[model samples]
Target: MPQKATAKFIVIEGLEGAGKSSAIALVRDFIEKHTGKAPVCTREPGGTPLAEKIRDLVKVADASDPLCDESECLLLYAARAQLVARVIKPALAEGSWVLGDRHNLSSLAYQGGGRGLMPLVSAVSAATLGDFKPDLTLYLDIEPSLGLTRAANRGELDRIEQQELAFFERTRATYLSLAQQDDSIAVIDASQSMAEVHKDILAVLQTKDW
Candidate 1:
C-alpha cells in the first residue's frame, strides 16, 4: 500500500487587497492537481464559530472607542490561537492538506511591523504556537498604495484596512524582509495582471521542491 501523504500546510499571505482570495483558489486547484486530494481551506481570524466572532471583534470598530494597538495585537493572536488549535492542527493530523488565506505571517506584518509590536507579538506567538509554521507561504507582493486603492474599490474598509498608508507600508516592508530570509516563502508580484500572477504562482509550485 502507498504510504499516507504527510499533510502540508500552505499559507497565502499579503497586505490588504493583495489578491489573496483569488490566490487561494489557484493554490487549491494546484494542490488538488498535484496531490489528488482536495485541500481543506481556512482563513485567519476565523474558521470556527468562536473564532469568527473573534474575527468580527478584531475587524469592526466603534466610532467613539478605538481598539488600542496592544489590544488589537493581542486580539488577533487570540483568534489565531483558536483557529490553529480547533481547525488547522486537527486537519493536518488527519492527513489532510490545509490552505490558509492568512496565517501567523499576518500577525507579524500587521501587529509587529505596522504597530511596532514585534517583541510582544513574538512572545505571544511563542507561547501560542511554538515553532509551528506553514510548509509553503506565498506572499503576494504589491505596493501599499496600490493595495489600498484596490481595497477601497471593493467597498467599506474594515478597522484594520482603514489605517493610514504608512501602516501598510511598514507591513509590506516586513513581508519583503521576512520572505527574503525564509526558504518556504515565495514572493509574487501582485501588481501584475491576475493571469500573470497566477502563472507565477503555478511556476513556483511546479518548480520548487517544497
Candidate 2:
C-alpha cells in the first residue's frame, strides 16, 4: 500500500470577493482525494471559540467606539494565537493536513498594507506565531472594484468590506508585492471564469511538488 501523505498546511487567500470560498472547497476535496482522508479545515481569527469572538469584534464595529488600527492588529494576533495553539498545532501533530480559509497573510495585507500598520503587524506576528506559516498559499488576484461588486452582490458588506476603494487597492498592492517576494505563494487571476480558475488551481496543485 502507498504510504500516507504527510501533513501539510495549505491556505487560501484573497480579497473580499476573490472566490476564496470556492477555492477552499476545491483544495479540501483535492487533499482528501490524494490523502484518502479529510483534512482539518479552519479559518483564521476563528477556528476556536475564543477566536470566533475576536473575529466578531474585528468584523463588526461600533461607530461610537471604533476599532483603532493598533487594536485591530493586536486583536487579530490574539485570535491567531488561539487558533494556532488550540486547533492548527493539534491537528498537525496528529498528522492531518490543515486547510485554512485565511491565515497570517491576510493580516499582513489588510492590517499591514490597508491600515498601514506593518511595524505593529510584523511584531505581533513574530510574537504570536514565531516561525509558523502555511506550506502553500493560493492568492486569488482580482481588481478591488470588481471584487467589491461581487461581494455586494452576495450580501451586505462587512465592516472591513465596507472600507473605501483605496483601502482595498492598498491591500491588493501589498498582496501582489508579497507574492513576488515569496515562492510559496502562487497568484491566480480570479477574474477568470470559474472553469478557468478551477483549471488554474488544479494546475498549481498538480505542478507544485508540495
Candidate 3:
C-alpha cells in the first residue's frame, strides 16, 4: 500500500500587535530550511484573491456604519470559505504544509468575544468548513494594554485595532479559554523579547517535526 502523506497545518493566532505575521514568517523560513519545502504562508480574511477583497471591506470600512456583530462574524467565515476552497485545501491535498497568520480562532476571538456576538460563531465556522482544523495553533498571549501600546507604535490603527481596550481583553480571554479547551493549541508569552519568543516558537515547531 502506498504511504498516506500527511501535511501539517499550523496557525499563529493573536490580537493586533501580537506579532503573528512575524511569527508566521519565521516559521515558514524554518520549515523551508529544515524540509527544503516552503510552507504556504497566508493570512485569513485575505488568502485568496476573492478573500482579499473581503478583507479590505472588513478592515477599511468606516465605524459610523459599524459592521453588526453577526455580519462581522459572517464576513470572516465568508473569507475563510473562499480561502479554504481556493488556497488551503488544495495546498494540503498537494502535501504542502500550510501556515496561516490567523485562522478560525481569530473569528472566535475578535468577532464572537471581542464584538460580543453569538458564541455559536465558532461552531458555525467549523461546520461551514469541515475537516479544516489546524494541526497546531500557536497563540501569542499578551496583555491587551501592552499589545495596544505596541500597535500604536507601529502606525495608524486599522478598524479592529481601533476597538477599545476592553474589547481586546475579551479577545485575549477567549483565546486563553480556547487554548485550555484544545490540546492542539499552544500558548506563547508574546511579551518576551522578540528573539526569545522566536526561539520558543521554533522549539515548539521542531518538536512537532514541522
Candidate 4:
C-alpha cells in the first residue's frame, strides 16, 4: 500500500450549510499556493459515477419506499467504498493530494450520533476503511439552527437536511466529541464571519508542514 511521496488526504467536514464548499475551495487554493501542486478534490458518497448515483438515493426522499436508518448507513458506505477504491486511492497513489468535501466523519455524525446507531456505524467503518483515514480533517462547527437557516437560504432542503433540529444537535455534539479525541481533527468555529473563518483556517494550515 505504498502511496506517492507527497500525497496527503485532507478532508473538510461539517453539518449542512457549515460552509464546507467554501472551506474546501480555500483549502484547495491554500494547498496549491503552498505546495505548488493542485489537489484532487472529491466528495463523500460521490466522486465516481456509481457513487454519485448512490448519493442521489441517499439524499432524495422516497415516500413509498422510505430509506431505513440501517439502509442509509450501508448505502453511504457502499458509495464510500466505490470512491475510495476507484478515485481517492488511485489519485493518492499517483502523487496527487486529495481534498475532500466530506468523508467518513459525516456518517459518524449523521448516522451514528443522529440516528443513535453508533455501534453499527463503528463496526461498519472498521470493516470498510481498516486503517485508512484522512491525514487532516478540518471540522467546521456551526449551530444547527444557524446552519439550517443558511441551508434554507441556499435552496430546497434535501432529505437529510430536512431532519429535525435535535438530530443536527446530536450530530454537532458528536462532531465536537470526536474532534476532542483526535488531534488530526481541527475544529473551526464556522459561526464566525467568513473572513474570520478563513483566517482561522489559514492559521491551521500554516502550522502544518505542507
Top candidate, metric TM-score: 2
Predicted candidate 3 versus true structure: per-residue lDDT over 1-210, tens digit per residue: 122368778899987788887898898887677666888888888988889988987888665787766777888898998888889889999988888989988988888888877457867876788766899999999999999999999999888788889999999998999899999999999999999899999888778743
lDDT score for residue 199 of model 2: 96
- Candidate 1 residue 83 Cα shift, in angstroms, is 0.9
lDDT agreement of model 3 with the native: 0.85
Residue 95, model 3: Cα distance from true site in angstroms: 1.0
Per-model TM-score, in order, reads 0.96, 0.97, 0.93, 0.97
Candidate 3: regions farther than 4 A off: 1-4
lDDT-best of 1 and 2? 2
lDDT of 1 by residue, 1-210 (tens): 222468889999988888999999999988887777888899988888988988888899987887899998888888889999988999999988899989999998889998999999999999999999999999999999999999999999998999999999999998999899999999999999999999999998888554
lDDT of each: 0.90, 0.92, 0.85, 0.92
- For model 2, the superposed segments whose C-alpha errors exceed 4 Å read 1-5
Error of 1 at 192 (Å): 0.6
Q: Which of candidates 1 and 4 reaches a greater lDDT? A: 4
**Residue ranges of candidate 1 with Cα displaced over 4 Å:** 1-4
Model 1, C-alpha of 34: deviation from truth (Å) = 1.8
lDDT of candidate 2 over 1-210, digit per residue (tens): 222656899999999889999999999989888887889999977988999999999999799999998998999999999999999999998989899999999999999999999999998999988999999999999999999999999999989999999999999999999999999999999999988999999999888665
User: What residue pairs are clashing in model 1?
Assistant: none
